[model samples]
Target chain A: MALDTKDVAKIAHLARLEVAESELAHYATDLSNILTLVEQMDAVDTTGVTPMAHPLHMSQRLRPDAVTEADQRDAFQTNAPATENGLYLVPKVIE
Target chain B: MHDQSIAELAEGLRARRFSSRELTQHFLERIERIDPTLNSYITVSTDVALAAADAADGRIAAGDAGPLTGIPLAHKDIFLTRGIRTSCASRMLDNFIAPFDATVVERLAGTGVVTLGKTNMDEFAMGSSNETSYYGPARNPWDTTRVPGGSSGGSAAAVAGGLCVAATGTDTGGSIRQPAALCGVTGIKPTYGRCSRWGMIAFASSLDQAGVLTRSAEDAALLLQAMAGFDQRDSTSAREMVPDYSAGLGDDLTGLRIGLPAEYFGEGLDAGVEASVRAALAELEKLGATIHDISLPNAPLSVPVYYVVAPAECSSNLARFDGVRYGHRCEAPKDLEDLYKRSRAEGFGDEVKRRIMVGTYALSAGYYDAYYLKAQQLRQLIAGDFRRAFEQVDVIMGPTTPATAFELGAKTDDPVAMYLNDIYTIATNLAGLPGLSVPVAPVNGLPVGLQMIGDTFAEGRLLNVAHRLQQATDWHRAAPADPA
Candidate 1:
């Protein structure tokens, strides 16, 4: 169950984090240790046990399709890193 | 005046002994003077606090005052405060001013409570020792070199250090109780959904719960009464009616069935902490309570289960912090993918990055059923253990932490060692039950906390037990020798 640098790199990529090459060794060791600690779950027999998503056994409460919030694009976008003409700006996706 | 209980402050205000403006100014000045050493506060809103205090004074004059009217307190930076920086002790939110108030903030403000400031916390409420804070670790008031248990460490330190009357804190996995134990204060994490989590920044949605830290359990009850309720904004907020937490404070413990969990007292418990907890139990026995041996067979798996479940939820919740909308952004990203990856890499800290990776791996294609699902199933086992134990006893009692506060950097290098610090308190979060920590005694001049776990929505009972303990002992009144 030990995580090597390659596995750490893959996980970091999936998580959308740009981990430096030098830090990969550190993360591999740390994540491996954490995985080892959590590996204790394998010892328990959870046969036929239901996987619980919430503690209260409650389902997601649904609301009507009506829009309850007012448009405050300017206020909400105040913290955005990049924005122009009431739209968030991102790098070009098209080739 | 700074060390007085919230109730005492309220009485003094009603008696016209001091104006709310004066009380607020006293705390503001104390923070300016004392917080440099403790690093407990992230922001001190002087003008906003004074204006609120002035309004409170007007309310008092008009005979519209409530129990908490004009009382000054601090909100943990995790809760959003409009027009103020809500850092959550992370560099990502360093410049992110919340556009609206958290439900907890709105509710407490409705009570005419004056907010002194926002307190520091572990980043995203992730760490057990406040060392992960981007601002800095909140020092334990009891011993400056020691850590105040986190991620509610700032709130605990502020209350214990007499910098504020009380403060709001959120518990995901023993965040509130563990810090309260180490800092010698009172804290309670009510049943999940007891308080609305609308604007309290999400960590582990299922495990995150908002509570309060105060010098005494009576003050905790007073603050919790204002902070707990249902809201339509939070879908998971319970529709249950909010009770008068302070009303039942005087209930005697005669015939109270207290369960001493065998798993909690078994091993890894420091002898000093165990002795203090046992001594606290003896005091409860003298108050006519009966202690019974109870077993929670799955309790030992709590720490492992939490690491899996909490990190998984955090990974999902934090995905919103990409470079596009808000939070920290990267410098000169070459493309869209670079924008996301570099921004996140630069924004998050080592522990946060480690958790994100761990969570991503756990939820990945080949491992979902093994790690994620297995953890969920084991979660139910832990909850079931609590359900069965509650059937036999009214409440479960144990030490809040295995030991007193450790030195600031003692376990920072080892992740597992830090995780085990919360071993005794995480099970209650996994079970989604209410828990309270009350200062019992000082071992080697460091405070120890006795934890009481109750069934779902039994916060009043937990507070009542803590209040009775405080009445029988002077531990809660023992302030730190050094306010610095």
Candidate 2:
């Protein structure tokens, strides 16, 4: 229940964020405080309640499979941090 | 002319009293002179707005002017604007621009409102105070050393400072109403899915509802009518009919049953704020409205549940900002994991990183049932409280915030303290109901907003009640002296 620096390190990795080793204790304290706050839910007796996923009770609407979007590679590509030959560039996963 | 309401301004345009170009120029001059101290605007498209104003003038000359024609206003940066930088006040999207417009922006433009560019907001709409914004905190117009309650702080300040006639704001948990309360403006967040979320940046999609901050309830009505409607693109958008919001403003509140929740007025509520809210209730009673004391027993758990649900959803939504496709990327990644980790760390602020980590931890292995699932179950009970309360009354009344706007950097070090600022307003969001804030009075020289919570799809009624109050009082007309 208590989140220490080790827990903070693990969470940072899972979240794909790099946290400096020295700052882990600070985050741990904050996250632990937040967790303590969230523990208030246990006070209520939610014996058979269903978790409300969305605000409304409506089911997701389904549409027939079709391509409604137009190709905007040029426009979309403009926002890419790194691109070459119409493809986004990232570090290669394969050696 | 700057103090005029949307309806009055529309009349002036129709009567040829002032051209849209002249109106736009006036606001531009004000923004130039006043915004340096207030820091309300992020991007101001001067040339584009002038050109749009000219086009609006042509529409007026040809007799095609709408209520919002040539009305220069600002959009919260959360809403996407085509070719305009729509930074969600985060460095991750500081240089990000979408090729299209958000549904709210598209719809508002369809009604002929000129854009004065985007206003600042709490980064990714996460923080209670706008201090988390990358552009720095927006000072309250009422008191320059204080904060304009956020994440719609800039919009609220813009409206209060008369930098713009009105502006768009998105409320996840009291973002619109809290700022409205602090800045002395009228703000309303309609029921979830009442406005399309297609172009609005996602921040807890289920709780985010597009709304407006304006000088008066009537002005809010005029803007909301244009913003609300169904859009096929947004899967959650409702099929309900958009009504004439302005038409119902003069409706009588003779038989209105306003409920005062006991939980809302308890400990932690400032004495000055409670007294101001009580005065507003007394005024409403004089108009034949009856007050019923009610109890939303589960309201206290709203902050806890929100931190869980919002962060959990944010983790999922923000995962798309990996270093690969768009947004900020690492300089030279050794590999994929390093690219993602370093890019996200470098791009995001401390609060953002903390939330993402918390969210990941909540939904992580073995903790999902304890954190995310439990929060959702508790969410049902909190929402149930509103449902039961609504069964007994037409609307619920309370303070918009526990206190008026606090000093800049006052609660910055204490996250929980900042989170509790929304205690009175978060339950409405959790219930997915429409809520509004009407400026009632100033407490300690800072504005206080009396919050009204109506049943789902009751925007018209909320606006009507707020409109009635404004007609009888000049509290909404209070503005700071020349934006400090």
Candidate 3:
């Protein structure tokens, strides 16, 4: 199925990318071409096929329930774009 | 001395022939002279590296040196390094100095390797070629006009150009092998879980495997032995025991059945590359190895399947980069949606945007089953082909890339054309198998990489075969005529 400008806009929104209205047509076309490639998957028969989460058939490895490394909030957030009071500060979520 | 392998360098360091500080300075001087033209490194931590080298010297003087002591190496920018700018070669993380070392970084630090600096890569490891990197493309050392194969292009270039002894590389769909092949260095991508992905910025987590790019297979063995191990922090880290990769370096390849996939030798493969790989296979035959022409029927479809699976995973992996978090944020946001949109648009590159869009489309409503799920199913078939072929042979042999390193901007405008460069190497990632790219010969002044693929956790065997090939040829040791 061909992706329209509206679909491209929606995907851009979902991805948090601000695609301009003028650029929508380009994304629509480029995304449609990529989708055409992805569309090849439809030809494969996957009935009764269990989706693989990992390549290895082993169970997830578990670790001891303990914090081995000390939380270095001051050290860790030293490079944050905006941090305050040892926490990453973001635009106020609530009005 | 500039072309010494990691093994040779380690031996020299242990024998007091040279101090780690002197070795680190030699590489620093090379980078200062050559890296401006090559653009192989994003950052070179000269002071920190010198300090680390001094510490390594202290260790050797005290007789506590490890196999990698005093050896200088580079890291793909995707791997986090404390107090270092780990940009992943994107403006999104341009100012993002990792607060802590990635598990791989910590592991290597444990082995006493001197980290010269961080190398450039495709932003978040999204592209087949390093052209997508925010820092600009890493030029191939062999032919400066061409690209060094990426997203590990910087690592491969450093080794090939003698900027560093060896460097860490992450492969998601041939990132390690492709560049290694093109740059005429030895690169290996261990099985998916063999190296902990923690702190190695995620890009198609299931497909991403951290490996080493070195001057020789023996150096790769030493690096892999140090990097491969279980990390409880990473849920996918293998709980299995880590093997002594060096011990298996001398393992015989005689009587080993090397499978030549008929599908890999078909149309689109350059005659020059085909001839070089075939010649390398013949050299192995002289070593008592048998070559069996086998078939991986589903191999051709790997490109499409990879585009779907990789993008779908990338779409999810990159979601964390919003205006709200630690990386890049929009200057000012009128609202939440504006924050998200403007931040991403401003932070990411065109290739990254294209992939995120493709990934969103595949995993979007009503298309998940048709595209994402179906692609996963096809990935299984592609993997099954490798398993069936492994039954008939001890290892698989093929060209690392369809052609040698293409010119800069050659395929940049055409995404599909760029994607085709990975056809030979993607199947290994899809199968979670270990693969190595060993330079065989020069074609059109560019080095051709012959890929060696082995079963899961078969890195030792893979390196052994690569080791044998290197011993028989000088291609692995061959450097560019003009190091500058």
Candidate 4:
């Protein structure tokens, strides 16, 4: 279950992180070590065990489709890296 | 005055022996003088603290004071504080000012508490030691060269150093208790959902819990009483009635059934730490408590399961920080793709990037069943172990950490080594039970915390058990001198 540098590169891409080419091998080693540790789970017999998503075994609490929040756009935009005309500005998505 | 208990300080304020303003000043002055060495605070809001202290003074004058009124404390930077920089110690939000206070912050403020400022923590609450903080690691007050275990390291260090009366900390895995153990303070992580996570930065949502670190369990109870409750804003917040956490402090421990999990005391547990925990158990026995051996067969697998589940949740939660609405953005990007990738890479640290990678891989197509689903199944096994153990015992007792605080950079290079730092404490989080740590004894003058794990929402009982130990021993009161 050792992840090679190529696997690490693909993971970095999938995760939307730009790992430097030089650091890919380093991350590969680290991730492989972590995966090795995770391989310990293989010893446990999880047959017929349901995958638990919540700690309290509770389902997601649903709320009414009502907007309970105030429009604090002006306040929130203060922390934005870039914004214009009440909308967040990122690099042009469409050519 | 700085070393006095919260009750003592509150009494002083009520009797006008000292004003809240004066108490705040004393702490501010101490932080100014001492924090340079400890690096405990990310932001020291002197003006805010003084103003709140004045307001507390007014409340006292009007006979409108509660238990924590006028007591000054710090929030781990992971909790949002409006108008103040809430850098979960990550470069991504290094400049991000929270637009609103976290629910815990608001609740404590409602109790007329004075805030000292935001304390430092592991960046995004991801590391076992404070080393991952963008600001810098908070030094252990007991030994300057050593680390204060994290991601709540700064809070523990601040309280241990007498820089603040107490501090708020979030525990995902062993964040609060591990640091408290290393720093010789009291800390508790109540049952998940017991405290609203509104505005508290999300780490592993299912695992993260807000708690307090204080000089003693009594102070922890006082602060926790102010901080715990439900908030509609937090959908996962519990609707359970908040109890008087301090009510059980003097309750007798007679006939208390304590479970000792042999898995926790096995190999890798330092002899000294085990000795100290055993000594604390003896003290409880003297108090009329009975200890029984119990088995949590699945407990050993907690660290592995936690690494998988926590990172998986983190990967999903952190997707919001993609150079978009807020947080760090990259330099002029050629296009949208470049913007996201570069901003994230530049914004996150090595450990954060490492986790995101592990998480992405786990949730990816081929590995999902083997890693993510398998981890979840094992998680239930781990939780089930706690459930059955609680049936036979009122509480489970063990050492909070396998060893005392290691030197900074000791485990920084080894990810697995750092992850194992939390092996004993991670199971409680996986089980979503209330767990608390009290200073049992110091091993080689470094602190050893005796952890008590109770059933869900049993925070009061945990605090009471911790409180009784503090009464019987002076270990919790042994504050570290100024670290050179």
State candidate 4's DockQ: 0.88
Rank candidates by DockQ, best first: 1, 4, 2, 3
Scored against the true structure, residue B472 in model 3 reaches a CA lDDT of 81
- Tens digits of per-residue lDDT for model 1 on A1-95? 89999999889899999999999999999999999999998889999998877878677788999999998889989999989999999988898
- Report the lDDT of model 2 for residue B128: 77
* Model 3 spans > 4 angstroms off: A63-69
- Give one digit per residue, the lDDT tens place, for model 2 in B59-102: 99999999999999999999999978988999889898889999
Per-residue lDDT over A7-95 for candidate 2, one digit per residue giving the tens place of the 0 to 100 score? 89989989999999999999988888878887888888887888988778898999999999999998999999889999988888887
Provide the lDDT at B41 for model 3: 96
Per prediction, fnat is 0.89, 0.80, 0.67, 0.90
The CAPRI quality class of candidate 2 comes to high
Query: Which tens-of-lDDT digit does each residue in B336-416 have in candidate 3?
Result: 778878888989999899998898878889888878788788888888888888888999999999998888989887777
DockQ, each predicted model: 0.89, 0.84, 0.66, 0.88
Q: Residue B394 CA error for candidate 2 (Å)?
A: 0.1
Which sections of candidate 2 miss by over 4 Å?
A: none
In model 3, the Cα lDDT at residue B319 comes to 93
Model 1 residue-pair collision total: 0
TM-score of chain A of each: 0.93, 0.95, 0.87, 0.91
What is candidate 1's CAPRI-style docking category based on DockQ? high
